[model samples]
Target: MFGWRRRNRTGRKTGRSKKQQFKLDKESVLPNHFRCPISLDLMKDPVTLSSGITYDRESIEKWLEDGNFTCPVTNQVLRSFDRIPNHILRKMIQEWCQENQNSGVERIPTPKVPVTGTEVYEILSSIEASMKRLDQCGFLESLKKINKWGFESERNRKCIVDNGTATTLANAFVTFSSDDHHQSLESHNYNVLEEILSSLNWMFPLENDARKILGSKPSLNKLVLLMKRRDFLSTKNAILVVEELCYDQEFIEALVGIEEVQEVLVRFIKEPICHAITKASLMVIFSMVSSSNHDHERIKTQFAEMGLVTLVLNMLIDGEKHLNEIALGVFDRILDSKEGREAACGNDLTMPVLVKKILRVSELATEYSVSSIWKLSRIEKQSNEGRVLFEALQVGAFQKLVLLLQCGCGDSTKEKATQLLKLLNPYRAGLECIESSDFKNLKRSF
Candidate 1:
């Protein structure tokens, strides 16, 4: 390749091919055609969808995996998810990288050949044989293969999940949980169980029958026992499985019905094993708290009575932004019940924390916190020791409430905010003039 030289600012001769990292800017622009529409990065393994648009194999596969049946660019219903390999384009990218090697462009290796149905069947058969013969060592090896293959590409995972690997794994999980086999292999049990759950997490949106297997009361009781293992990997995987299966109304209600399950989830929240597990636990509990299967009030009251109110308040006090937002949403939902309200009011920190989170967190957090305040304050000012309003007023909630109305919110939230303002208006006398970063945005004329 011919090379050229350029001059530096000091008039020294410098090479034009000086190695540097490429970023999205005019100086080192990546060709538009080389970039995947979904990720906007140079495609290492381009594949054309049936819609005739090319994207990185991984990006497009993930899009389809998320249940989008249409082209992301065209939004047209896809007749198929077939993604033909664009080999020619990949070669062009390689040549360009070779010509610009000095510019830090590395050659993209060819993507792994997508897993075939036959390959998946071979692994599934191995898992089944090992399980039937009670070969613990063989069973663990086969599960390792499933986890590995599923990680290579979304296509592989699709193949694994579609070939009924999920049901097989679920059945194996049930046996391990119910049978006494696990107790004998105490130390090795963690590895086998972790792989099973880690692989299962990749097969979410489980089939209805599969959902029932994991949702059964016995399975759930065992799931609690697994969590108590205190192994981070196993606990995280277990939480993710429950989070996905919890999409079903029946699974949620079933988990809630188990006192042990409730206690375990609450413990996970009170002292998280890790951030990811903690967040997933919140999602599962949120689903449980939000269920409308038969009696909505019953579900709300159940969580409210389990010290969820106090836990949420404490989380809001120190949780990160997104986690705080979720905690507030749960707080608002539970507040719909009398028990939830009583629990909040009983804790003297409730009003202060709820009022504090209103404008201090994200928009969604603000809405939920405001809604919670409205719910807690909706009762007669004469009732509940007047703790709701007086405590709110004592914390300067009246000013924050005014600022919230100034910022605006959903129509329902808007109405509730307005009603809240009216309720707190009479107590506004002698309060310091509203002042804060949020107050500066207020229209002086209004």
Candidate 2:
């Protein structure tokens, strides 16, 4: 490689590197067939489809990934997913690059062969056998190999998944979850669990059968075991899986009935794991008792009895902006039920804390905070009207509501702020001076 000093002409050394100085000549155009039709660039790894159109392997793979099954150039429905490598063409390209070594074009490295479905099945068999006999070394080795293969390419990972390995791995994890497995947990098996989780993460948005296996009683027990272990990687991966399962309504109902699951999820928030785990824990809970769920009222009563109200109050006192938004969203749902309202009202910090969050965080957070105060105060007035309004006003809910409406917010949020403002207005006598600015428009709604 020639250094800049050697290529310099006008005394000072040129800043260009050898590759830049040797860039492919624009005048010496590349052969048209050598370029990928999609990227319009020289092909690195050429492969042909059943439609007889050739494309760079990476480009075609990406096109397929985006859910387009048609050949890009031919516009024909691809009869197969098979991408036969054009070895002859690749060799020709390599020879041409070598013949023009003076140019910046470098020969592309040989693309690694992706793991086939057959090889994936073979590895799955090894993992199953290793798990059956509790062979720590064998299991760890297989898990690491699975991770390596998955890391090679998204194609390889998809092949491993197509082989129905996700369910097998989940069942294996369930078997390893019992105290029987805990006897050997502190050794290599512990780290092996992380590897298993890594492999599972690669196959996420798991197939229906795999989700059924993971959402089962055995797997729920396994998640509880992992969370209780308090090992960072294990807990993080376990919660992520739990979060994924939360999307299924059936699983949400089943998970809500599991006190152990509820306890661990709440403890993660209370004790504070990493932000991701904490946020995921909250999301799981939110999914469990969201109003969209049929059993939301019953679930709300259950979580309120478990002190979810107190936990969120503590979180909002010091949590970051996004966490505050989620917590308040959960808080909004909690107050929908009579039990949640009572639980929130029992705490002295409840109204004041809701007021504190109103305009202090992100716009979404303010919406949640304002909606929560509106919910609680509206409900609490049935029993304790004096104290609810007193606390909200004392904490400056009135002033925050004025500014929130003036700054402009979502239509729903704007309506919520207006309603909350009306509720807190009568408590402040002679408030005529504050009506001319942002509140001028809101005064009509009030």
Candidate 3:
């Protein structure tokens, strides 16, 4: 009976052995020690949480990202979300995978060492000490490291700024900028300035107080001179810092008083600088003109004659979609003054291009573009500029308004569009081609 059973089992195994071998050739299950508790897979860049739980770095980071203050598995309260790298475990996993290569396992690649806030703090401390002795090389290197780390995480950025990173960076910027004034700027100086710029760029979305502190420290003249630098990085940072500085009325006045400031800004606005630089420059202009004050009006006149109205209109016509909304926003601000209104309406392309942007971009863009038309139309209605009214008619402004009402916009935008249509009601003959049901339905409301 035993012999018969053995023969039968051998017969059953003959065809199944190859299939079983194929299954075994696949990657074997990872040993528990080599697996992340969170991922339940072989650990890649294993780290120990404050809860004393080991997990994959990315998995644990994501858990923390989801706003968890406890370990996912243990449910224990975590004193901190900071992770300690389990280098020994990572090495063991790598060696184990290498030893198990016959089972078709792939080696886990090493992970990049992330920059920590502590590291940034230490660097800042060293730079603070070095700055006292006027040795900038170490300060420059440390600033570069801080900038790099700032880009890594929002938490790290906040840490840097909260620790007075901007004040430190601002002082360095002024020092280097003043040094350049005493001599022709060397390549090394430009390199140092560029690094300072990188840090400033990362340190933005700052509070008004922080901006004020930074702006005052760097000094307006130094910032404007930095704006004259032709390099993309420094130019971009210069304008960004200037825009933030313009939050203060005095700084705005000071910046506009600088003759080179407007020239450099307009030149780059028309020049082939990167879109980011152009955007920053436009925002500075916007901030200057956004507020209603004597200084703002004067600055508006300064920019209007410099052909800012024309330049913004042309940007609207030819610029990318990302730039369209900002251009319209600045265009709206430019409309606050009589000179700006005349500049905007004087352009043959302005009415047509302005009308084209109504529903073509974002809702915010539509609101701004429509608001600009309202401003122009309001001025025309009061001044009896039949020619300007005729231009809006010729550009299908009335029809776009009718369509905008039908399509639905923000409440304020809808009201502005309605108000604009009423202003243009005398020119309703221009919209004679409207035949769509939506347009027809909207006409009754109009």
Candidate 4:
């Protein structure tokens, strides 16, 4: 490998740095054929596109991910994006690496074959055939295999979604759910049902059509029950499916009308928290509450009556930074009614938490929290309802609002904070600490 003494411009080996010596020792001059055109490095897992140009799989995948439709070398429109492995070239490269073992060359391991659309179709066909025969165990096993494949690669995920896997699983789940006596299912059949629900949860980009199938009342009840299970991953998946199903007003109202559904979601949002499930539940509620414009007050009234306000308040107090932001966003939307405002102020921790987050968590959280407080102040000013203004004073909300402006919060948050400060000006004397030097200094600054 070091047959010839290669030297720099000075033609002296004594002046070579340790880094250069190391590079020369490990990475000897590679044959041009061994290098990828894109990265100009030793090829690993080389694959060919329809343009017939071979490139490293990682480089080509990154190119495609960047939205390029043409081959790198050919600059030609790709006839197909399917990547075919160059096994002959790969074997040659592996042999060359083995021959150059002293140069620190490592052998490339065999690459996983990219999933094809045809493979996805065959799996779906087998699943359909097995399900028709009432082969519960076989069907469950097939679904599990597909689920495992779906998580392996983005290509497999797309193939599964495009080949009607999600739709089929959703239909099966809906059919099983429509049976009113599912409680009497045999143990194996019950396990199959769980797998079906779990498989449906695995489906990504759950399109509107599949969502429509699962949004049915019966289907929703099944999902809620699945979400209530003790298993974290299974429950998280069920919550994801439920969020996808709440696509519009009718579906949202149907879900909201299910008291147990609301209770379960609220319970998840509040205790023994799984962050993913909590985020999904919050998103589902946001979609449901935001979908209804004409019946928003009534919907918000129902959620408030179900103790959603207190649940969300507790979440805001205990959730992590990102969760706090989403919880605040959902809480802001719910504050469209008197009950929502009263529920917030009734919780002794709400104002304190809102004020505490003014410049904390994130910029998005700051905006949402300020919006929630602003909504409360407006409601209080309009209806002479709760002591929201006094509560703000009690929680140092006024000082926080003033500090918010100086701390470089977003324009919207600063605007809302300004408006809220002005709205609560009438209650300034209610602050017992107003005469203290710190309070006096902040009040003057405001």
- Alpha-carbon RMSD, candidate 2: 7.9
**Ten-residue region with minimum lDDT total, candidate 3:** 437-446
| Clash pairs (backbone) in predicted model 2 | none
The lDDT per prediction is 0.77, 0.77, 0.74, 0.75
**lDDT score for residue 46 of model 2:** 95
> Native-vs-model 2 lDDT?
0.77
Between 2 and 3, whose lDDT is larger?
2
Listed in order, each prediction's TM-score against the native is 0.72, 0.74, 0.79, 0.79
Report residue 361 deviation for candidate 2 (angstroms). 6.1
Displacement of the residue 103 alpha carbon in candidate 3, Å:
9.0
- 106-151 per-residue lDDT for model 4 (tens digits): 7877767767778878877887777666666777778887988888
Off-target runs (Cα >4 Å) in candidate 1 are 1-105, 181-191, 205-209, 293-306, 337-339, 380-385, 433-446
Cα error, residue 40 of model 3, in Å, equals: 4.3
Candidate 1 on 1-446: residue-level lDDT in tens?
Answer: 32356566987555543333233232355678999999988899999988888999889988987889999999999988888999999999888778777766678887887887888888878888887776789999888877888898777888888888888888877766665545432544556666778878878878777778888765786676677667777788888888888778878877777656777788898886778888888888788778886777887887788788888877766677779988888888898889998888787667777777877878888888888888888864547455577667767777787777788777887888889878887766765533232322322210
Model 2, range 1-446, lDDT digits (tens) per residue? 54545433666657766555555353255788888999988898899999998999889989998999899888999999999999999888888877766655577777788888878788889988987898878877877887788888877887788888888888776666542444443644566556667678778878888788778876676666677777888899988888877888878877776657778887887788799899999999888778466777888887788888988987776688778888988888888888888887777767667776766778877888888888877775667556777677766778878888888989998998888778777788743332112221211100
Question: Ten-residue segment with the worst summed lDDT in candidate 2?
Answer: 437-446
Off by over 4 Å in 3: 1-33, 39-42, 49-52, 61-70, 77-82, 96-106, 112-117, 144-164, 175-191, 206-210, 243-254, 429-446
